[model samples]
Target: MGFPAGLLVLLSVGALPCQPITHGDSAKQDGHCFQVLPAEEGALNIGRHWGAATPAATVHIDMSKVTSTASSFEFRTLDPEGVIFFGDMGDHDWFVLGLRRGKAEMQINNIMTNISVRGGQRLDDGHWHRMLVMNEGDSVRLEVDDEELLALGHVSYPIIERPVPEMRLAMGGLLLPASHLLSPMNTAMDGCLRRWSWLNQTTTWREGAALRAKAKPCFSALRPGSFFPGAGLASFRPADLAGGTAPPNGSWGLEVELGIRAPRQTGLVLAVGVPDGSLALSLVLQPTAMVVRLGNWTKLRLPLPEGPCLDAPLRLRVSPTQLALQLGNHGGTLPNQPPDFQWLQGTWLGQEGRLFIGGLPDGDKTPRPQEWGAFRGCLRGIRVQGHQLDLDSALFRSDTIWAHSCPGAHEGAEAGRRARGHGAD
Candidate 1:
């Protein structure tokens, strides 16, 4: 079938192929242009004085792809960073826009005052997002995908009192002093960026503008190549079950091989039981120990040894009579403590129940947001009733959970399928 006219036009204007522009491309080119910022490497040096010429400016960026991994203050943006617009020689007087804690933020600091505005939604979901920042007079407004964020007004005056000799305008990161280069705060963004412009009047950044880097950074035009680094998991509704029904005697067993990425902070890693009721078995990761809950009672709180959980695989085995926890060769077991309620002693099967790994199941089938309890890190294996299930297949096919598996771990299996153009499912 022929491509629709409107769709073709849109693709041509914005969604250009991942083509690299070298330093020899052109001395100056214009209109609807993009430059790739290699993950954690390379940046466009768009002239030291590019944006220093104007203060009342409008900036638009088509973040073609964002691969932020975690919600912590780590992941930074691979966008138009570094002296975003204007800054003084002292470096304390400047404005910059970038990502923090998975959200976009714009900060303006001068000799007199410092102000910052943060976006409402997180933008690390491996998708293209549009961002606009406009500074008119004393007000600055930020919009993400057309949604308006809180605007800043009465911004301090004298945006830049005096001009600096070498004002830097970097695309992937800021120009920091040599002493601060290795600091955790100095990490570069790890994603693709394109269609960035600064001005009320729309004009492409000149392609050949002596701003290209001496060596091009490696580019992965495909999706940000990894799983979500924070806590998240998949859910299986009662209707999605494929194996024989869950054991009906309330004496079933579950075995899961997972690695804890972060110390648990009041979160549920795996849960199985009926909907909206207290009758359930949950595995929780805590700061000091691993907790297991049956109904309203705490069955066990196994203390963790003094070492990183990532050093070895964690194996958990659960049944009505006992619970087992193992890290590498070390292991521990405790008798199951039933809740006071009689219903908890009955079979976990034969009802409209649900199963969740890496998170609790929401009432409906759709995946819940990350803010809704999710697990972090990797799940190496999961088995129920001695039947091993493919974690990758379940994750790609399930609708009730919001989990992601490590791409590196699944390289031999699903990753090969994905490279062969197979859908995740």
Candidate 2:
């Protein structure tokens, strides 16, 4: 069968007014309405904007011809995490291509092989990159710009051996309710994708792509840290976390470093312990005090200095012998605290390996409200255990967690406000 003949498109929304099918509508002679419209001109812009009303920006391509192997695409992004494409071959064999920690990644899975390869980091500097992905005998090869991936960057696999039936490249993320175990950025992308060429498939990008949400006039996304309104929450268990569960009890250690700007009086800033049990460790802000609870036994409340600039650098470190906290030079350390909170030595963090930022809602409410009210503040640039967390790409987040919502944001940075001309130079 012909390439385009086997191809079918499934984008979400109508990008334009009624346009005739280039495949030619059979009902045109009868003067009846037909389906579809032309693709947006230039690079296709898509994002990971999620809600009950906001569907995924998914693009599906047919890749069942095993004899045809080469494919290429061009990309540019400011986001460091988000699903770019998830290909399902229907036999539990699949592949994902996207950005992981600002580096290009390709994860392949088959019967006996499950491996990942990463490219150079910091690829998200709003720069354009050309990628070539093709089969190299028993392994898959990936190249960025024109440089071949290094030795550890290629994997032995069965991808080219069998046909690929179904493949999806969501503009910004994976089409979940799927697995996020491989790529943790199970969220939307803040970037642009264009000039996709797959296996000499005979079709224009316009005709091949299934447009979802209107191709937004791309903009510079304001990522001045995520603003968590009262009653907001974001949770995740990163895939890179070793072993997928809490580590050995005695070896358990935690560190939290955050730049906080809390204008509100009371809010739960961060919690890294059992949700319902008394074994929780939490950081809560109340008017003039920053209270840190280490389990149910030790609670330290430090009064805030009276002044403006409701902002402070907060750091919390937990070890076997010491509980260290620093809030803008106003915190004290408690030594030999492990014996006080026995739960600290054995299981400071539960087996779930979960970390919650912001407020947790009660399950009894219709649209669940916060348990002890919410945290009305912003957590800027959080680093936990030496890893930076991307709030926009969490596994789950409350509706109120937002960007460009923090007060004093410059409105001039909004989408469609500035002009940017892209060149491959």
Candidate 3:
């Protein structure tokens, strides 16, 4: 099924439209560019976003096949700062394709010397462009759309003497920030990428069978995964999770809905930001009710008809005038005025930032609310503005976020150990 309008932020880059092609309609391989989202600014090691880390589209490279060959790809974009591609040797040696001030740039570096050359053609003109790089033992030839952009190389610099046996080749970003040589402009490319080829000699990156296993097409497509909380944490950028322009009133709406399944009945369904001050906001599930906390201490308890043996849906919606909460088949709506809900008037959803879901790690530096206990349950079919947050696209998360299964006592203890260690660090 298609994504329900929201969460497309994690799926899409700029607002460029995509033209999906049919198998029989061989109009052209290189057609309208598919929009891609930039990689969320996150730690490369502990953070992994869904749908490939950077360029969104990814394919593996069998380094042994094209150990000594060139790389090429076609792209269409108006962004000038995203990396077209990056490959490195786990150190200072690497090769990169990028745009600097709208001009195509190619750089290759090693422990010894580095070479960089730019193309005269300005390519950020909202049109398709092809980049070809042929590296031959230091000397290189770079081209754009079949025309030679520039060529340069150094005697001591060899891009990757022994490249990683398998490397994920991406469109406009690296699978991970695996290089110190990557410049700030080497960030996620805000454009479309296609026809990527390298490392493997037999077929293109898309057509390769073994390599294709690890790559994802994009995050725009919809697929539901369950969040079984344990020692793990998951979060999404507020902008991406609530994928909508602010209404003419200049106020963004915030709504959170979730499906609950749990062995333990207590859990923090979500926390918008740290639970402090007027910015603190969170949703929590208890044995008897679902608690909605707004700002420092104001709370509205949505009591459930049955105890928390919940295997049903729960939704909470907040607006300038009213608040609504639902559990399974029972729920209520209240006006956002006066005595009980004056706390609801603050428009802090979008401004509050990251939405922390499931398990929120507790450390000495960032001790979470004790009532905001780890969600020892599975949260599924999560929807915000009809869109579902991608578990894989979390900006920062705890390790071992399992899908389809809940962690047991042993796992929980392990998680505690890990959290303690993380807190220590």
Task: Pick the lDDT winner.
Answer: 2
Model 3 scores worst on lDDT over the 10 consecutive residues at 1-10
What TM-score does candidate 1 get on C-alpha atoms?
Answer: 0.39
The lDDT per prediction is 0.40, 0.52, 0.49
For candidate 2, the 10 contiguous residues with the lowest summed lDDT are 1-10
Question: How does each model score on TM-score?
Answer: 0.39, 0.51, 0.43
lDDT of 3: 0.49
Clash count, one per candidate: 7, 3, 5
| Weakest ten-residue segment in model 1 by summed lDDT | 2-11
Clashing pairs in 3: 13-36, 13-37, 49-392, 50-392, 50-393
The C-alpha stretches of model 2 lying farther than 4 A from their native spots are 1-55, 58-77, 84-123, 126-170, 174-221, 236-253, 305-309, 319-322, 334-340, 349-354, 364-371, 387-408, 411-425
- Each candidate's root-mean-square deviation in Å? 19.6, 12.7, 16.3
Please name the candidate that would achieve the greatest TM-score relative to the true structure: 2
For model 2, residues 134-161, the per-residue Cα lDDT tens digits are: 6554556666788875333234433444
Between candidates 1 and 3, name the one with more favorable TM-score: 3
**Descending-lDDT candidate ranking:** 2, 3, 1
Clashes in model 2: which pairs?
12-212, 48-188, 231-374
Candidate 3 C-alpha lDDT tens digits along 158-214: 334544564444455564453444344435444445444453343343423432332
